[model samples]
Target: MSYAIGSVSSQDLWTRLKEQFSTVSRTSIFQMKSNLQTIKKRSDNVSQYLQKIKEARDYLSAAMVHFADEDIVILALIGLPPEYNTFQCMIRGRENVISLKEFRSQLLAEERIVETHVPNPLLSAMVADHSSATKGSTSPFQNNSSPSSFFSGGNRQFNHTKQKGRGKFNQGVKFNRQS
Candidate 1:
């Protein structure tokens, strides 16, 4: 320890000591910022994800680097998985900025909604039936049978007759063609 201290000049020793004690290293700050930017909510719930973000923000704060609530909110939103797209959009489209507290509450509520959601059996069956019915056909209207056969019903033929002077505009018109 004495040798190490003696190697540094007295004039530079105080300055080095002050820098070490008073300042956060640039690399440490960069690492913390990177962590904040790339944080993901892959399998975590809303509360866990929010807690991670809060921890990162707190670390930055301890280093004397502070982020606005809006910035933190944005970071949190961006970290969310695709499942939260609608919720994320709702939060982003708000006219007024959302406070962190409000954001947390809203996220928890949304999480509960998502967790408690149940797929309707009838709806699921309908979807499955529709998909199976249309699996081999490119267009819904496409069929293996002929158009005439498909629409066969009632009368097979129609009688055509032209009437003269059927309307005010046709009063002066004459029908010369036979049907």
Candidate 2:
């Protein structure tokens, strides 16, 4: 240790060591910023996305680029995929500026709602003409019920059969054409 100190001053040695082992670099900061901008929820849950945002924010802070809470919130929203487009619009349209805590809570709540949503199978039930099925005659709107039902024909009685494994009971929806 004495021999090493005789060759170099402590200040010069410290500087050399710091130069070689420093964690902060211009390229790393730029990459962190780029990562923050391009991050998406994708397969990650709301909590995981938030954690990534926090990590990037922390990295920026460590690099001496301090960001406000609102800026972080905006960055998080920007990183979200198009699936959250309506939610993003709603948040942006609010009269009062939302805080980071409030935004996180709201986002988590929305994520839970999206995850729990079970599509109603009744909406896509097939419409079979009661008359055609009884008398063995093919009708214009028989076998399928699509959005085009509105333009198909006049008012008719049709049986709504739920697709197999979708539901057990069959229901009826009145098909009405508007003038």
Candidate 3:
């Protein structure tokens, strides 16, 4: 390291250092801005995602480069996953820009709604199986057995016989007509 031989005032030395190292600050600011743009929510929860964004903003602030709250809000929305598309549209469509606090609150609420509404894979499979099984049945109550057999406790002794007909009521019935 080189040392100054003459006594240098602290202010003079600070000025000299900053003038020499100004490029470092510019590079730091550029990198931080790039990082902010590329951030993504991916697997992180709402809070974690917001925290990551706020940290990047904080770094920019430390480097004397500050973004407006609206800009920050836009950045946050841009980094959201596709599942939040509706929420992003809502925010973008607002007449007034939302504060960061309100944005955070709404985002968390939306996250809860999304979590609650997500279909369970197992439940979905069960429903799909049930619908496929019942596809051709005329009535929801119709199962493997004939209606009489189904209602009569599966007794095979019943005289009911299957017949081609317009409806269930006439399927196994006999009617006499008098002229």
Candidate 4:
């Protein structure tokens, strides 16, 4: 008896494939296909980018909160290049800040500031003074341009530093003026 092996037709092959698919449960195949489709899904949600932007915006807002009206006046006075030693001055018991708009006007009155600029020392003095607890008004310097005034003797911010006292009282110095 001779067996016809290669004589199996294309129809027989299709039947074998159909029988295999039928043996496998349709519900399990559908669940696996759905799972694969879900895993392969791509979306345009920029979650990471949005999170980064939120973090940057939060940092910017925090920086803004640190800036106040006093900071504007301070920057106007001292400029941003040099360091403001307000914290250090407070440690030395000096309590002052270039916070008064009136004070800026007073310097402008003496033509010390070029009608436009206040130096950094004034801001440094103001920052240092702000850190200290004061008991009395720090305004003796406002009385007159005396040799012993804290901010007097004209606008020291614009004065020539005569070598007579190079570092004694050329610029904004602190003094506990007693009445």
Question: In TM-score terms, which candidate is top?
Answer: 1
Q: What is the lDDT ranking, best to worst?
A: 3, 1, 2, 4
* Candidate 2 residue lDDT tens string, 98-132: 99889999999889877887866654343344444
**Global fold similarity of model 3 (TM-score):** 0.55
Report, for every candidate in turn, its global Cα lDDT versus the true structure: 0.78, 0.74, 0.79, 0.40
In the order shown, what is each candidate's alpha-carbon RMSD?
Answer: 14.1, 13.3, 12.1, 26.6
Instruction: Tell me the deviation in Å of residue 118 in model 1.
Output: 3.0
Encode model 3's per-residue lDDT on 61-144: one tens digit a residue: 655688999998998899988879999999999999899999999999999988788778999987876677578775435656
Q: Is candidate 1 or candidate 2 better by lDDT?
A: 1
List ranges where model 4 is wrong by over 4 Å.
Answer: 1-7, 41-179
Task: State, as a TM-score between 0 and 1, how close model 4 is to the true structure.
Answer: 0.18
TM-score of each: 0.57, 0.56, 0.55, 0.18
Over 4 Å off, model 2: 1-23, 120-150, 153-179
How many clashing pairs per prediction, in order?
A: 0, 0, 0, 8
Candidate 4's clash total is 8
